[model samples]
Target: MTESTEPVKINKWDGAAAKNAIDDAIREVLTGDLKCKESFALIDGRLFLCALAVGVALYALLWDYLYPFPQSRLVLIICVSSYFVLMGILTLYTTFKEKGIFVVAKEKVGNVTRVWEASSYVKKHDDKYNLVLVLREPSGKTREASINKTFANYIDSNGTIVQNLVASEVTKLYNSLSSEKKEK
Candidate 1:
């Protein structure tokens, strides 16, 4: 009897699909309660811009009265200084917070250096299972890889398998690219 080996299935559009999925995941991560600092920064930034515009307009309208009063200048100074102080406090808080677990890697392909953050999870669909992976950069560039589910005694509950898989792939990618660069 001959052993049968089935050819693997590869999705041509996996990169694009994974990019979209990674974006969704990143959005979910960023909007969670623990990630409020990013949201606060965005809101505060817009507010600062609006305040600047209002201050400019007010200054124009009240140029005559404002020019004579040193206290008005002092108040403006205090407001701007206070905004910076608040942001500093928030930054300190975030610095002290526990960071998220991520598998991070750096690879240089050609002349461009890439930093990748990767994560993986399993999902079920139509009574079947799939392992989904997302690798993305802070700048929104993404790539994806996946594995079709196979029979297992148990899925890893502690995420050790997933993290190891990501780390292995990242290492392989970086080594391959570095070797290629050396060959050239």
Candidate 2:
């Protein structure tokens, strides 16, 4: 229930208990620190909204400067507002259109089941122990995306997301899975 502010003792993370760490933090922890120290503690969509608001306000200031005449001031204000509004809309669309989320798979789903870096829509299933991640491109396009699996450990509906797993973690998982396959 408490977060470890005790400081990260390791510079590198081995994939030993990452799943358990991620799962426990997501369920009970309210805040977390990511690799770059970026806090995803809250998934606030206000970022875009704030940028848009600032842009609009700046455009208003510009409009006032451009129009010394009160009669023309109204027209310029409307035009500048409209232009900034369009630009802001485009900016938000482009940012949200990029792949900002990824899914990691645990097992093979179909013939092509593999966990590569891809965007997705994740939901906590009725069995909170398991999560369902529906992969989709950030373009919000109708085209299909590759499906992958991840156990409950990596996601913290409550914590901020760190850079996906580190390189060492991926290597560890791959090696473990490969060995397990050889055994089977």
Candidate 3:
């Protein structure tokens, strides 16, 4: 018997199809499996506490100098106001910046399986799609992963193939964990 020598052909996913697949994967993992909800409560609470502390400290220290120098009071007021304005701007920016897709898969006992935020689509290489992912665990690490395009199946109304490759990957990871637990 002769063995076939032809190499297997892999379909390349690029352009709109790749983007749509990646987007769908991110959306499915985030919405369906991961169930990650965008939250600014923690950040907003921290900022509020910090602002309160700073305001109290400033009032206590500057009260003595305010009456002595009228110009000094004005300068202090300007500095404090500017600081608050800057902080407000930064808080708003952060709120908006963190609104992107966040995927979080957990182990059986609620341990973190994976935590990544999809920043943007990078590029397509060979039969895979590259995405810029911000890993939230292990200290906000940023990395890229080449997602295989073979997992995508759904075709959207716009004629683009929507892939849930990430969701499939997460499901694989979850199954692996279950198997490991069974082995133990």
Candidate 4:
């Protein structure tokens, strides 16, 4: 008996198709299992309200105490209002900005696959981990996503563990794909 040696079929996706596949995979991981949703509305609402209230209160309470000059009042109002306005603008911008896991780019080098994506968000003041998963096969790609820390929360109120969850999903996908290549 002789063993037959045959070339294994390797599955390859075109650039656009690969991107779509990665996006779909990310969406599945993020939405289906992780239960992650855009928390922009909640974050923006809280920020706007807080900033408005604080600005108004500061202006009202400090108006008469600061100085009697119209110029002084105008300056104070401008200063306070500007801060709130800036905050509102930033919050709105960040909120409306891409609020979900998106596959920004992907490439294949040799036997390795590199995928760049914006996967998570982090607030301005938050000091927590804000890493977006950079999936690389053969682990030599040095690209990174400029993911902003916006608003994202898990439906199960397990927001604190989102990073670990997302990382695990990324790893799972990478491993699955790597195994597929190995099978071929």
Candidate 5:
């Protein structure tokens, strides 16, 4: 479906719906690229091949000199160790990469033309939602807060709802600050 240029109205959205909408948007940003599963499969395939070659060479060298284990078990040992190492490395790499992508997506979705004093994103932990709000002051400093909020059943596929919600929240914050300044 085509994305709407118009801002989504926040008044109609319940808290759960808004949180779901944000989560959907973040998921899209996380996996929208690469198009198909083949890309990932291909990556793992190449890594496996490389790991196998390294494992074989290392095992041969050790068997010839150190003889770390029984010669008969070289193949089995190398294969199992290589597999574990490959999995461990991939796990770490994927975790860090995905996290970086998540942070970038959150920053992109939360900041509205730099008008808002800060930006925010929702992170799901177990059954709860944690709103990670980053506050940027006029002094060019920043602070982050993770506020846990409860949300129930709701769904919104498009990102517009979450975007609008953030904008609305920022606007309200700005208005409140302005009023406070005036009163002072």
Candidate 6:
């Protein structure tokens, strides 16, 4: 009789080590903050221009209509002014929210670098957004979060969609940060 060879099924995930490796990768890809400042700056600039455009349109209309009813003209100007003010305020709010704030912070080197308060977007188990921060050192760090649903992107630098780095990638990023801290 001839001996027969059987095929064996191999499963890569047999322990926590494999899981940990996957997790670290997710963190790194999800949290890197290389593009927040430039991205938000672009957004704010565009918004200011939009607000200006709206103001100009309103003003031109008011300018044309004002002579007919001076009192009404005053009212229209006030209303348009209010509109621009609101838009300006909203623009500032978004700029601040996305770009984040800065303060004394730590970096990979254990030396405090001027870290910018920024977040990254990441998708995971489902389509979700994760917050990635950029350190003053300007390295990207992933945080556990879900950015507001309204989070919009404009002219992303690094051409990164900045979406979820994934659980696996995030794990790797976390490892990198750990290594960075160790080095310092």
Error of 1 at 173 (Å): 9.8
TM-score preference between candidates 1 and 2, better one: 2
The sequence of per-residue lDDT tens digits that candidate 5 reaches over residues 99-164 is 322222212323331112222334444435554433334446555544454433222343245444
Q: Taking the tens digit of each residue's C-alpha lDDT, what string does model 6 give over 1-184?
A: 0133222122322222323332233333333432111224535665776777587667757665765665567666776777777677676765765443211123333353433333444334332334453433445543332233311231123222223334334344445554564587
* Per-model TM values vs. the true structure: 0.24, 0.30, 0.34, 0.28, 0.34, 0.29
- Arrange candidates by lDDT, descending: 3, 4, 5, 6, 1, 2
Tens-digit lDDT track for model 3 on 70-177? 656765666567667767766665567544333333222356444445544434444344444444444344344433434233334344433343556555544543
State in Å the error of residue 16, model 2.
Answer: 24
C-alpha displacement of 105 in model 5, angstroms?
4.7
Could you tell me which residue pairs clash in candidate 4?
A: 122-149
In the predicted model 3, the residue pairs found to clash are none
Worst 10 residues of 5 by lDDT: 30-39
Q: Model 4, 87-130: lDDT tens per residue?
A: 77666655675354453444455665455444554344452324
TM-score of 6: 0.29
**Ten-residue region with minimum lDDT total, candidate 6:** 1-10
* Better by TM-score, candidate 6 or 3: 3
Separately for all candidates shown, the number of backbone clashes (residues 3 or more apart, or on different chains) is 0, 6, 0, 1, 0, 28
Q: Model 3 misses residue 60 by how many Å?
A: 22
Error of 1 at 164 (Å): 12
Q: Where does the lowest 10-residue lDDT sum fall in candidate 1?
A: 151-160
- Candidate 3: stretches off by over 4 Å: 1-25, 34-114, 122-129, 132-144, 148-184
